[model samples]
Target: MSTAPLVAVPAAAAAVPRHVAIIMDGNGRWAKQRHLPRFAGHKAGVDAVRRVTRAARALGIEALTLYAFSSENWRRPEEEVADLMGLLRIFIRGDIDELVRENVRLRVIGDHSRLAPDLVAMVDAAVARTAANTGPILAIALNYGAQAELAAAARRLAERLAPHEIDEAAIEAELDTRDLPPLDLLIRTSGEHRLSNFLLWQAAYAELLFVDTLWPDFDAEALGAAVAAFGRRQRRYGGL
Candidate 1:
């Protein structure tokens, strides 16, 4: 992390957010409203991912974390699950060059043990190939569930603690997001008004933004509007 200042400035002049997290919601609903298969909406959502990543990079945002798949999603119909995984494979195979060209670093955060070996390999390749990129870091949360993450963090802490090393800081340090900055802003689209267990620990102080646009339709303009709204708020961090 940089030692740069967090000086407050006019909303228009404020430095772009260092970290932004998004819950890509409403894909199935979007497709339903259009009388299309849910997978179609998911596919459309992928295009939105490309657009928002470019916009975030252009705006100089340092990190963008997207909730691509949650652990709960595994309970859905097997066909839908298969479709989503297929899309992920296609993305990894076809999008590597574009990602490298854009200087974007791709990362996957979540348990991948249950995923097919081929998909796992693809994700690893994407992360390794873009590891050196200097542009915005894009983290895709796949099979990620915040409660699961917290449990995993606790298990790690318990394994290391000999009853003397237990502390709040120690537990926090064991979290997966220890290296990432605390979330500055969290956005959820499709008019949903809940966190859905995304970034439960890391979003402790993040400003929440909700938009009516579905994931497939979310674009740069929507993002800009969200940022503008965030700029107007007073971030007290529990201080008066």
Candidate 2:
């Protein structure tokens, strides 16, 4: 019930977004194309995550939010869900040192109440381990849904105040991403042009970029291209 306001970080000079979010889509499709199990693509997508993180940091992005798993993702086969959870465990354990070494702070945004106890522990550990880092914030959206986030924020606001006190800023302050910068650019891969329930509230003024590259195939070059494209557009925010 902390009423702390979210601080907004302005983008660095020369057109780089202060915050960039990516819908890491096409893991299963990438696997299908390779004649491999979907898990293989998910595993490979981890490499892409690493690459993109590095690229964003090099590009001076202050925050990078990655859509790792959505709330609807649980509807996937039980085995697939288990596999994804296993991957989460592995990534947290295997990558924390590297993230710390690179001075990256790990932040997980979602309704983690449903997550398994062990997975939650690992997530908490990762956050704690990187809590001191001052580098780029790496936000992994797991079990996250935009509608759910908004609903939760609304509920929190309602409980904490009377109707007269609730406002856009109040709701935003209750959001999971309230600690991070406002989203500036959101990229979706695998030819998807939709938000897919990722950061809907935070991306109100963000530039959307869609690419055909699969999640696993996304690399530094692809990331650079997306940023370059973003640089070419004018964001008027509903005004001329």
Per-prediction TM-score, please? 0.91, 0.93
Model 2 C-alpha lDDT per residue in residues 1-240, reported as the tens digit of each score: 111122222254657788999999999999999899999999999878878887787778899999988999999999999998999888888888888888999998998658899888889989999999999999999899999999988888888799999988998899999999988899999997899888998989999998999999998878878877788889999999
Candidate 1 minimal-lDDT segment of 10 residues? 1-10
Global local distance difference test of model 1: 0.83
Best by TM-score: 2
lDDT, candidate 2, equals 0.87
Off by over 4 Å in 2: 1-12
The Cα RMSD in angstroms, rounded to one decimal, for candidate 1 relative to the true structure is 5.1
Can you list the residue pairs that collide in candidate 2?
none
Question: Taking the tens digit of each residue's C-alpha lDDT, what string does model 1 give over 82-122?
Answer: 99999888878877888888788888778875799888888
Report the Cα lDDT for residue 127, model 2. 94
TM-score of 2: 0.93
